[model samples]
Target chain A: MTRSGLRGLRAAALTGTLVLASGAFAAENPIKLGVLEDQSGDFAAATIGKVHAIQLAAEEINKAGGIMGRPLELVTYDTQSDNTRYQEFMRRVLQRDKVDVVFAGFSSASREAYRPIVDQFNGFAFYNNQYEGGVCDGHMVVTGAVPEQQFSTLIPYMMQTYGKKVYTLAADYNFGQISAEWVRKIVKENGGEMAGEEFIPLGVSQFSQSIQNIQKAKPDFVVTLLVGTAQASYYEQAASANVNLPMASSVNVGQGYEHKRFKPPSLKDMYVTTNYIEEIDTPKSKEFLAKFKAKFPNEPYVNQEAENSYLALYLYKQMVERAKSTNRDEIRKVIAMGDVCMEAPEGKVCIDPKSQHMSHTIYLAKVGADHSISFPKVWEDIKPYWLGEAGCDLTKKDPMAQYTPSNPPPKP
Target chain B: MDIATLAFSALYQFGDAFAFLVLSACGLAVIFGMMGVINLAHGEFIMCGAYVTAATVHAGLPLPLGILCGTLASAFVGVLVELLVIRHLYERPLDTIVATWGLSLIATQGTLILVGSTMAGVGTPFGSFQVGAYSYSIYRIVLFVAALAVLAALYALFNWTRFGVLARATIQVPHMAAALGVDTRLIYSLTFACGAGLAGLAGGLYAPTMTLVPTMGATFIMEAFVTVVIGGADVFLGTAPAGGILAIVKSGMTSWQGQLFGQIGLLIAVIIVVRVLPKGISGFVLRERT
Candidate 1:
């Protein structure tokens, strides 16, 4: 049979099933939640934990009899660390599995790839990653730290603790390079000079010279943005050289993976900014930690993406309970109107009324010699940098909200 | 600018990028030049090599053994490609490109379905042996030097060895070599495997610098195309050094200038050079003076 005929048959079958089960759909139909992420590529370690955590959340929710008497079904698709795969996965989830909600795509690149498709189909995508933010869409919610929230909170604190001079490094990509630009602005505005910045390719080695330059510049602190193991390698080189510059990272730089470079001395006294801590002073965090450890005891280390996905599913449950339906339009409306606040352990988080993003609290923690991410401080009231001073009003020229205007325009 | 500082800084950025680019370019050049097979699935061959290295290392195999098995298996996979798919497409360039591209997609998706969608990491098992001030991952530097050695050996193989001479003769005078009782058809398979083996070698070497993803092979393939085309696909020696120079300049420009402009400038340069010299400058220079 031809493909169109197969598609037609499937669509007809879908319509017939929906019509017959319309009355029982709310209670009996499986409310499929698509958890799509970079599964087989560069981001698996950071994101697989999230997929497993979401599964755990689903199982626990299902055992508790799910939201509003319906079973919470979780289906996962790995974007294979490619943008094209993300689109394909989204299609398979929406059309094939016919999921009600999805935690689709991580990283700014994947999110950008998914936004238009989600918007076109009138579905919802809860993006859970810290990014250089300038998002404007109703069907999307930015759960991770936007530039203003993550940078403003850390930069001033680092400057006060270390000094004004800062050195920057990041992966050479759309997200990392833009983030480095923001860090430079944040440091300079707070009475500091950017002492040379480096942008390594997506996967490059040999940081000897970048290390030497940063050491020679004598920067009081470093705002490192490199991700994956390159993030770990850069830190290892620095720590070994005894470059005691107080460092901060938007990426999960000094996690267990980085510390594994050598035994201990290679990755000590490093810091990272994230939303969830394995040791947060909360009952929920404690309970979640134990449960997560039981599930992922072998890979006991968890990153923010894992926590974000778990919380998102639970939040979807709460919203489903509050709204009393699985209507994508209604959920989209409820999220955009910002009437729902999750029982977030990091703190109570609600979607920003206008941006349609969650108001997540960002935390700064230092990795100790034993490889524990120690959060000594936390910042609430997180907002994007665009809403702050450096935000450019490009809405006029970019009336459709597709193009972005540069802040502090080009240096002649 | 102080040329030493500028060149040194550029070289610092250049080593990793060039190592990666040249590793694949060297392989593709050898295969395409010697065997005349398009081999679009070459990147996947490299990817399989890295994963084999990772899996073997994870399975409690020695690091050196893992590297050895990975490259051998990669070469084996190349032979498999030669046997299953490309064996028929020897005379069809477009068909070979299409078939290999499909194979690459299948391999990528198959990897996703089997291993998972997350990135797997490989490490240097022997640990680090650093010099005084300048530190390096012993494994990666070892790979870098190994790549050079392999290139030198390959050069000597083609220039000084009987197999190389036979292979060269097969290319230069296929009809004459066939009349002289040379098994020209067998050389194609052998050369294809050797080229794929080099890609695997590059992948195994690069496994430590960053995470190994199925898509990684594709990224390096793009670099391979750039280097191979610029270096002179027909000639191995001149193409590699020129490609290395280009890659370093491309990566180093991002540090001094910005990523966007640096890349844009590199693109423009590549376009202009290609326009003025279609066969590539290296190709023009490498041509016989007579």
Candidate 2:
């Protein structure tokens, strides 16, 4: 070889050695957590809170020394709130970004749509939202509460306390149909009869006629499964029309639900089955809230979306560490097995192994006079609570018990 | 709640939705029917109108004055469109549709790039009130009334004014109108501008009901097309209001039935009814074209 060629070869060899040395350093390589979601659509505000939560946890974890000493990287995409895009985007994150796990898929439709793709790619997904039931056998890990969290706990409590009859209104989508069906089943099981059921287009206004028809039904209470800005609009219309039954909603009637346009004083008597209430005053929650407020003073304190997003990131990092591998299937098993826990204020947040759904303490909160939700106690006996949590509990107690204590209490 | 309560509730629901149908359909019918341009970008025009109102609000103008200014800005934009790209594609309606559709995409994306992806709520023009078991959104009621007033003015403008006659003559026979010393191109340009302005005003009115989003135009555009097609492109100004009302009834009924499927099914039913009344329900009701 010529003298110049030898020098070039030596330089290339030196670069290769540096690259090898960097890879050999355990903490040098970064593991990516893809948070693919529609942070600006139907579930934008809600998922935004979750995303923020994921980020907060990731930051803290990295500061405390990241999973396997490798820092976490969070990349996000806006799914535009469509199921197809949601599925497609996550697939891209898995195939292209080669993320160890995805930390998103907000709605039931999105979860369902993305499930097959996750299985196809054999990638890990940490779902950070609540969904309808009876679906299991997915590689993904759901980290939010389930139908049991909302329907089994809150609906029954409302039925026994308020009345054994209720009227329900749901949005006109797959999530609505399944949610209403679950409500009907739970109500029937609890000796409650559904007085009436109504479905509205996702965000179309003018709900007066439906309100009037509902008034005629005169159920003990109203249950709304409305998603998006319609929640505020419905309450506004209902309050103005003097439709005065106390309400229990499947959706959170908080800041993200178009509070800028239509904050509701009528919602004073309203309640919802939420994973987190802004009023919860845990050290972690307070810190999260303070950090969130400091970041966006004008924006209302973080909603469930940001919280879930934040939690998702932590779960991804922990699962990856527990598995001791960035391999997708290993991380999937770690999350599904509920190997690690996060200090989620929503109660002991864990994924059910079989169903891949989050099993957490579900709450039935009443909207106080101050326009805030107050949870009386940690709610229990939420159905399909943990996807695999129940399956692993081979020896079981009375499943019919109204409220039971959390197996392993989340952070005090 | 009595049956009267329910009926009244249904009436109001129909009224408000009908306002959207009419207001949006006005633009859809004029652009599609006269120029044979789909003008899918029409909703973006409405969005621009809304943004104009927002800009006016940001400029410290009173709400009503802001809305009025926004409407004028929409008119100006409408005229600009006619003078520029849209007017050139009049003879090629399909090309117009495709080109305008591209414009719509560009405008919507441009909005996203400018304002933001966050949905911002606008101030409602009217306060709210309740009656019995039904509450009426004063803003929506105002929309219904405004749409009615605009429809009446449009009717008078077309049936009773020289401009309307000239426009009608040009639409019926563009070449013949030119021989009669009429400026067909100017008439077309004016109508196109009016349609575009109407769309913008709609955006302004709808702002309170929905937050501003770049892609919000897609939903309204589809709904507008359905309303226009079902109402009959000819004499759409009259049926435009009806289309809005019909959507209200259909959506309300969906609550009693299933979910969105019921809404889709009802839309199909409307199509069947339209087939039966080819000239439109208005022509069928009148027994003649007039």
Candidate 3:
């Protein structure tokens, strides 16, 4: 053999040994987690904050010593608020990226779209957004506060504060329709009667007729389940027509951040139930807001979904630590074992083993002038009751099905 | 609520609804009816006016001046759009639709880029007063009066002015008007600018009552297109009756049933109008063309 050939062989053998040595070094490599969120479409305003919050959590987790000994590497895809994109990204995260866990989904519709993919691939999905509730999937864990946890406090309070007669106005969709049904049930339970109920279509901005009808109905308060920036117009229209009935919603202040979007007095006196708000006086919240604002100075606002997302990662990290493995089955077992907990910005939150939903502390917040929020009261460790009522037992995992309001008094 | 109060409430709703319908549709009527160009960017024009008004008002300009600036900005943008795109595609109405749709997309995306998704709006100007058990908005009443004023002003512009006559004549017989010492291009441009200005004015007036966003145009476009189509080719007369009829049907059904039924009622009214009078209300109301 030539002298140069012998030297080349030695170099190749040395590199191979180094590669093997590094491969044996367990903590040298990183574990991948997926973040699929709507970054630039209709849901962007609400979901973008969630993306940042999760990213912030990942950074903090790495700084505080990541899961086991490996640093968590986030593989993100912006779903652009498209359902098809959500399904595509969900599949991609599982099959292509092979991420250990996925923290994603914004709207309930998008969650429904990609949830089956997680099951198909045997992947773990952590959904971190407040929704209409009643999702009982085994492969997914929801960290956001659900409607049952919110409306249980909000409805009775509004009914007691305002008169016995209530008017319900909601967007014509699953979230709106289902929540409105809950309002009706709660209203009846509280000895309050619904004077009138109406569901406005998702994109309908012209509310002259609806406003006029609201005036004629003369309800003591209007419970709005309206969603989206467009539906936020109801506040302006209602205020313009001087249909000055008090208003309350579970979906408003937290998701849309309407208090910030709307001018003062428009959202004044409006009540909401949410997981977290900037106005929260808790030390955890203040510290979190300070950190988040420091990291993302130009961020418009951090919402409930964002806070839930930040906590979701820690919850997943807890499960992973308990399981001592990134294996999906092990993590699933740990999650289903229940009692997964995190000291969240909103307060202490835990996973309901039976339903796989968050037992979150919900605050009944009122919008003050200048878009300040005041917590009139807080409902501690509120559990998701709607799913249990719908026969969802996550521990069994025999069958998973979504529950929606079945018997709504026809669309108005 | 008492019967008198209910009746008055219904009347106010009808008037307010009519004004909104007319304000959104009138610009389209002028553009589509006169030029036979389907200006798909009409709503974006209105959005531009709204954004300008919002910026000015927030910048400490008086409300009236802000509105004027908004209207003028819309007009200027309208003239620019006409000069750049519509001028070349004058005779091709279908092409105008496609081109203007592209323009609409550009305008929407541009606005989204410039101003984020949501823009805060001004507080509603006037307060409320009780009408029996129900309180009514004075601003809505003002909206009704604004609509009437708009109609009257449009009437004066179209019927009494030399520019309006020449413009109408040019659109009716472009070759003849060109031969008779009229600049048809200028007339067309001016007419298009006027339509855009009307849309801007409507947008500025209504901006205070809405949460301003780049996509705000989408909400107005469908109603504007429907109302304009239902009004037929006559700008003023056709649109007024169509707005009144649709508004009455919508508001009445809404009061009796709900918002869904009200919208359905409006659609039903339009279908009935289209089925009976293929050329719209103007075709029926005026047997002889202007």
Candidate 4:
């Protein structure tokens, strides 16, 4: 062999030893969990608690000896409530940092924006916000409550307590549109009539016409699926206009904590179906809230989304431990095996393998005249039945599609 | 419902729509219509007013006093803004728009950084009265009256007061007004201040009805701009009638269909008016009178 060849062989041998040493070192290395969420922007106020919750969950897991005796390291990015930022950060986290798993996206638009990128990288992610149902992706887990989970509990209670006639004012978007469809279906199934339905575009603050129309229709109650800060003005406007019809919503006081934010009687008599709220009066919930407050002393409220975010980390940790590996495919396989339950602050929440959605307890919370929240009723362990009914068996096949009422999977 | 009740509902809706348009637009009317500066920070000024009013009310002040404080505060800030930023960009209309837009972003973000995103909102004070099956807010009626009061106040300020005459002369013919021994610079500052104060007043009036947020100003901006645009440059001749017409179109379409259609109708009406008249409703009216 030439002298240059001997030098090359030595260099290769040295590099191989270094690689072997690093490969062993990798097991001791911290697991990188990417958190992509809106920390500052349009949805910042509503989502700040969520980010804090993730942080708290990570800290707790690290304190308790994280997944597989490896410390959990968070790689968080603020998407700033912008869709483009979601895409950019998703790619950065998955392709660049190569996070083991990502918990990202607040809005459906945001989720959809970064979802394709996740698929491209074959990445696993969790969307931890309540939304319109029917996202069946093999690479993602939806930890938030879907329409079937929320409306199935809410609409029936609304119809039973209030009357048969319903008026729905939904935000004009995918979440709102699809949720409105669910409202219609649930209302009809419960033998109730939809008096009027209006899809108010986002950023529409004025609702005098809407209030007037609601009065004209004279529904027993109004089902408001309004989203965003601007749309929250509907409650204030409706109160001022003295449209005294009891309002029921899946998205209002729970996520935004509108009752706590707005003054007395604005959200009075509002029936909100939620998985969690700051006012959840349970030992576990209180303990979790106290811990959260101790950590994030300035956080406004522990919203439903925050609870979902908090529990999602624990869920991920459980999957990692059960799978005995942080490999995405192994974790996904563990998820597909069946129920992976966790004792969440809200209640016992379990992951449904068939649809990659959660089955959890949902509460019917009512806002009193003084803006206090009270749980009047609750449905336990409500599975995400709509997707399964729509033939979205992720175990059978991953269509990687979102199904709406107008668009469903072909009947099996 | 009875015919009388139906008519009352329609009338109430018209008043509500008119109040919203006029109040939101009045400040922009003075800044954009009179001074020819498209003050994009108009919304920020409104936000300032709302924040101050809400904060003051929460701090144990009466609602009216809080509103007065909010207006004065905005006017003071307007003067400062005029002296610092707007004065430099007066000759550059497009630059003024950009500068004010920048100012708006800074104000919004600054408010966000300072006070966080949301604060507790003041409750709408007045009770509602039932007519047939429908109930309407008395505060909304108060809003309508406040809108008219604001317009009348503006009219009196411009048409009746000595400062109004000077402002009018200064805005219309600056050199002529300057040569005639008018302090044109002071007039410009005062006019801008008044415009901002009116915007603040709109914010104060509506603060009770809105969810007080850093970006709450955006909700008012679209209507304000459209109203000012359709009203034309002549604030006195333009704004009230423009508000009235737009209110009619908005309320008509709203009652005919829903708020979505109402908004669509308002935009469509703006398009048609801008297309035909080119200048605006006031321009058409001015031409007819001429």
* Candidate closest to the true structure, highest DockQ: 4
Going through the candidates in order, their DockQ values are 0.16, 0.38, 0.52, 0.60
Q: Rank the candidates by TM-score, best first.
A: 4, 3, 2, 1
Could you tell me the lDDT of residue B72 within candidate 4? 93
Candidate 4 clashes between residue pairs 3 or more apart in a chain or in different chains? none
* Best TM-score among the predictions, by candidate number: 4
**Best-to-worst DockQ order:** 4, 3, 2, 1
- Candidates in order, TM-scores: namely 0.79, 0.82, 0.90, 0.93
Deviation in angstroms for A102 in model 4? 2.6
Q: What digit string (tens of lDDT, one per residue) describes model 4 on residues A1-412?
A: 9999999999999999999999888767799999999877667778878889999999998988888899999999989788999999999999889999999988888999999999899999999999999998999999999998899889988899989999999998888888999999998898989999998878788888788889888899999998888888889889987888899998898888888778888888899989999898899999999999999887888899999999999999999999999887788789888878989999898889889999989989999999888889989999988888878898889888888888998786
User: lDDT (0-100) at residue B245 of candidate 4?
Assistant: 91
Q: Residue by residue across A35-99, what tens digits does model 1's lDDT show?
A: 88766666665677777778888988999998888888878777766788888888778778888
Task: Please give the distance, in angstroms, between residue B116's alpha carbon in candidate 3 and its true position after superposition.
Answer: 1.7
Clashing pairs in 1: A39-B117, A39-B118, A40-B117, A40-B118, A41-B118, A41-B119, A44-B118, A44-B119, A148-A385, B231-B239
> Where does candidate 4 chain A have its weakest 10-residue lDDT segment?
A39-48
lDDT tens per residue, model 2, A61-134: 77888888888888778786788898778778989998877876766777778877877787767766665654
Best by lDDT: 4
Ranking the candidates on lDDT from highest down gives 4, 3, 1, 2
lDDT of 3 at A198: 94
Error of 3 at A197 (Å): 1.1
What would you estimate as the lDDT of candidate 3? 0.84
| Candidate 3, CAPRI quality class derived from DockQ | medium
For candidate 2 chain A, the 10 contiguous residues with the lowest summed lDDT are A394-403
